[model samples]
Target chain A: MKIISSPLELKEYLKGENNSIGFQGSKSIGFVPTMGALHQGHISLIKKAKEQNELVVVSIFLNPTQFLKGEDLDKYPKKDEADKKICKLSGVDVLFFPHVEDIYGTDEVTLSAPNVRGYVLEGNSRPSHFNGVLTVVMKLLNIVTPTRAYFGKKDAQQLNLISLMVKQLFMNTQIVPVDTVRESDGLALSSRNVYLSSKERVEALKVSSSLRAASSMVGKNILDSKEIVKEMRKSLGDLEIFYVEVLNLDFEQLLHVEIGNTIILVEVRVGTTRLLDNIWL
Target chain B: MKIISSPLELKEYLKGENNSIGFQGSKSIGFVPTMGALHQGHISLIKKAKEQNELVVVSIFLNPTQFLKGEDLDKYPKKDEADKKICKLSGVDVLFFPHVEDIYGTDEVTLSAPNVRGYVLEGNSRPSHFNGVLTVVMKLLNIVTPTRAYFGKKDAQQLNLISLMVKQLFMNTQIVPVDTVRESDGLALSSRNVYLSSKERVEALKVSSSLRAASSMVGKNILDSKEIVKEMRKSLGDLEIFYVEVLNLDFEQLLHVEIGNTIILVEVRVGTTRLLDNIWL
Candidate 1:
């Protein structure tokens, strides 16, 4: 797989070399953007992308603007060689590994997240985080111009906001959300998972378990949102809970969990690292 | 010209009917976005578009968001039939006339103008104006997906900010800066010119004349910015002048007018109507 760093080169490369890898059919590029250290979650996203299109492109950009000042941006895992190997093994057509300076400039024309949906849950905890996320995602989508971009349901809010951006901006590409990847123990896989210590690692399981409880509650016909949230908060058992919200597809607070339209989310601090997990019913 | 009101219909129309009006070869689209009172200024843009590309699209959207709360949004000139005739006469392939509802939504994902460049001159006077302009322009650009988009230099700051946005966002379309078209009497053509009474119409000549005086001074090697600004202000002669300053192409204030790299901008109120005129040195 060819790795390109420049935005212009990637745009032109995406345009002119449509059917380069001998998978010739109706031309399409499925894109998966990540902040490197490809985990099972990223691989799962890549797998969905590969299945859907003639070509798959993965981007590994450590977008700086998405992190808050105290957030561990510098310490975010970067398995560069391993990421490249993963891309190769997954049959990625091209890898976009851009530098911070290359992607951003001074006095940028940035994006603002939606006022209502953007201010709740993840956006609430890490304010300006979604703005950075959206700006970088927009830049990446413009650069890639893929037929379909794959986003995992693990970052449900990010995925939702991105889909909204594409719809609101009238962008042509489709945003396909893949199911969240989880470990055998039910902990959602994340790049930040590497930051957890042994004891913290065990504690992180609470996040997934709570989300699982929400799913189980929904399965057993416990439709009231207040009851689900109450039980989810109870399941955490003294962890640093940021929030446990039962929201609709639009991210609005829900009184009752409407099956097939509900997303139950959890953000809790396991040691110094924050863990996020969710169940989309 | 086929006029389309829906954004989806327009995108599909622009894509599928590239060669419908019977101009062939490489399939380039030149777009000119306007606010519906098509005068010589818009005709000039359409003329440029026709010369350059195989197809031409003109959007006549009087964007409500760009107008401030007390501004003349309701009273803005709307010569719908005349504008349609102008596009048909000018050989425009399509005319996009989207409604506010079709173009914008609740708590939308929007484009913010750059902090420094976007907060001066017109942006200063009408705060959040450029943000609205950029957001609508971004929506239109995405919807149309033109090969090259045209803007008038009469709205010099608007042109600069749009170019900056396209560059900063890594957008693919080329932004062509069309020279401002003017009347034989030297009044810059504007749809808002309709608001001027017979007396204010004559008084409005002072705006362009101020820009001309600055230009003539620069031509004679009077390059000092302060001196040029002083003379321009004198030329305005106690009218309701908003700002009379010389700045570089980057919109940063300049100590000296560096010939090809300078712009002299002026905004003044004549009666109850605001007029803007500028000269690119």
Candidate 2:
């Protein structure tokens, strides 16, 4: 697998590959952008990307802009060598690892999240987080020019907002949402999971259990959002809940759950590490 | 020339053309986006676009977001039939004329101009104006996907901001600055020029003349920005000067003019109609 650090070089390399293929024989490129410290979730996304296209490109950029001042940007995990090995084993055609400076500059033009939709749920806890996610994603998308981009559904709101951006901006790439990869104990896999202590790791299971409870309530036709949220809170007992929300596919708050269009999202602090989990019903 | 109002249809049309040509045989597309009260200035941009690319697309969208509340959005000039004829005559391949609703939606993802660069001079007078301009331009650029996009230097700040956006966002389109087109008597062509009465029209000459005076001063090796600006203001006597300042190419205020990298910009109100002109030296 070819590893490129500069966006310009990566673009030039891709352009040359495209030119060599000729227009009629063009190949579809599938891309998976990540913040490194790869987990089962990221590998799942990469595997799905490899299945969908002739070539798969993975970008590992711990974009600083997405992290708020107090967020653990400085301590965010990095496993560069392991990530490279995983990319090679997963059959990635290219690995794009760009520096913070290469991806951002002074007085840059930025993408603002939709005021109403962008500031709810995860955005509520971490304001300006989605803006950073979107800005970096846009930069990556422009550089990669992929036929399809893969995003894990574990970050339901991020995935939703990204899909919205692609549609709203008329960007020329398909955003495919892969299902949330989970642990045997039902906890959603996250890079932040590494931050959890042994005791906190056990408590993190409450996040997934809460979603499972919400899913069971939906199965029993308890479609009212308030009742599901009430039961979800009970399942997540003693965990410091950030929020438990029932929203539509578009991220609009719902009065009641509508199957196949509703998402029951939960975020909780297990020790100092905040964990998120959701069920798309 | 084909005139398309739907962005989707235009995108599909372009995609079909791209596919038909095959990648290796693909032709370059040059684009000119405008607020459609097509005049000689718009024609010049179109003519330049035609000379550069095999396909030329001109979008006539009178974006309302750029206009502050109580501004002349409702009364902005519209000469649809004449504009169409002029485009056809100028050898434009496609004219994308989309409505406000076609381009915007509820709680949309937006582009914010850089705080320092965006809120000075023209931006100072029309706060949130560049945000709207950048947002729409981004949408149009994505929709058109042109190899090169053309902008006249008459709105030097706007052109500069647009170019900055393309670079900062890592957008693929090349932004080409065509020299500002002028009337026989040196009045810069603008759709707003129609708002000026016969008397105000003559007074508007001061706008361009101020830039010309600044240029002549630069030619004589008078690089002192303050001295040039003072004389330019004197030439404008009683014309309600908005801002008469010199700045570097990046729009940062300069203590003294640096030749080959300076822009002298002026804005003034003539009978309730705002006029702006600038020179890039």
Candidate 3:
């Protein structure tokens, strides 16, 4: 496994890999980009990448630009030694560990998330958040030049926007959304979950629990969007619910629960830690 | 030579070409993107592309986004049949002619030019102009995926911004800056030159003439930037000079003309039609 810090070095290495002999299949690459503090969620994304491609490249870059002015940027977890161990064990072919200076310049051309779609949900709370997310993603995808990029549905809105970016920009890579990884008690695995206290961890479960109830309501022949959201609001039990939405795959509001197409998304604050979870039907 | 209006078809064709075995030397593509009304300047660009690469792809797209509201987008000249003939004559392998609808969507992730560089010079008069230019360029570059794309130094700021975009975005394609093509009378060739009436056409020569005088000053070892600019203003004879200054390749202002590194750029209006010209030393 190679650990490359420079973008140019990665490009050179990838170029050689593309041209060199002895690779299986059509010399395809699967990339999984993440912020550090790798948990079960990141591991699952890497696992899916390894299963599908001749080479798997994982990037662990805690981008500073994505966090808002008062967000938990400095407080974001950093478990580098543990992350390295995870990658080595998980059989990652390349690990892109770029410094902040290496990734950004004083003046640069950046990606802007679409006006309407980008400003709802996660974007509504944190404006210019998706713009930062997309700018970094665009850079990483170009640097890696992956044949397929893995994105967990845990960040469903991000995944959808990335998919839109890929389609709209006509990028070479394919975006494959892996399922959300979860804890035994149904809490979605997130690095931020570490910020949760014992009591807060238990409270975080309400997020997934609400999503699960929405899923169950759909299973019990509850097709109306309003009915499910109303029940989800009750299931959440008012633990500082930011939003509980029933959206189509396009992230548009839907009146009817279209099975195989609807996503039940929930975001809630337990104490001070914010948790997001969603269920794709 | 083939004329492809659909981006998907062009991609498929390019893919086949990449895999095919009959090309001489390493299969490289040189691309020249343009709006129609082909002129000597465009022909010069095509000629350079033909000299360097095995395959040359030319795109003639009259992009609406780049023009500000009521900024001659509707009045912009179009010479479809003549442009096609010129492409065929210039030995272009593929001519990508796409309509506006095929290139844009309702909701899209777009490119934003850097604040300082993009919003100065041309961007100052027309805000968000470079954003549209960059967005379309990003789309076209991704769709064509050329080995090396070509741009004339006639639009030095645009070329600089495009180069910046490709570098910052980590795009695979190289931006090759071709020299500005000029008329025998020293007027820089442009599609908008057709909008110049007989008297205005003669007045437009002042733009190039001012740059020429500045170049002569540098030849005579008169290297002070302000001195050169002062003399240039006198040469221009106050024909509505928008901007005339000395700068380095990075587009930052230079106090003294650094031989082999200086650029004298001028933007002037001739009877309501703006013309830009620059001489790189």
Error at B171, model 2, angstroms: 0.6
Q: Cα miss at B78, model 2 (Å)?
A: 0.7
Residue-level lDDT tens digits of model 3 in A181-280: 8889999999998899898887777888888888888889999999999998898886998888999999999998998998888888888888889999
Off by over 4 Å in 3: A22-26, B22-26
Under CAPRI classification, how is model 1 graded? medium
Sort by TM-score, best first: 2, 3, 1
Mind giving the per-residue lDDT tens digits that candidate 3 earns over B136-193?
Answer: 9999999988889999998888999999999988999999999988889999899999
Candidate 2 chain B lowest-lDDT run of ten:
B18-27
Residue pair clashes in candidate 3 = none
Tens-digit lDDT string for candidate 1 (A218-281): 8899999889989989989999999998889988889999888988888999888888888888
lDDT of 1 by residue, B155-184 (tens): 999999999989988886899999988988
TM-score of structure candidate 2: 0.98
* lDDT by residue for model 2 (B1-281), tens: 99899999999999888778764756799999999999988888888899999999999999999999999999999999999999998999999999888899988889989888998888999999999999999999999999999999989889999999998888999999988889989898899999999999999998888888888988899989889999999889799988998999888889888988888889999999999888888
Clashing pairs in 1: none
- How far in Å is the alpha carbon of B268 misplaced in model 2? 0.7
True contacts kept of 1: 0.66
DockQ of each: 0.55, 0.73, 0.60
Error of 1 at A226 (Å): 0.9
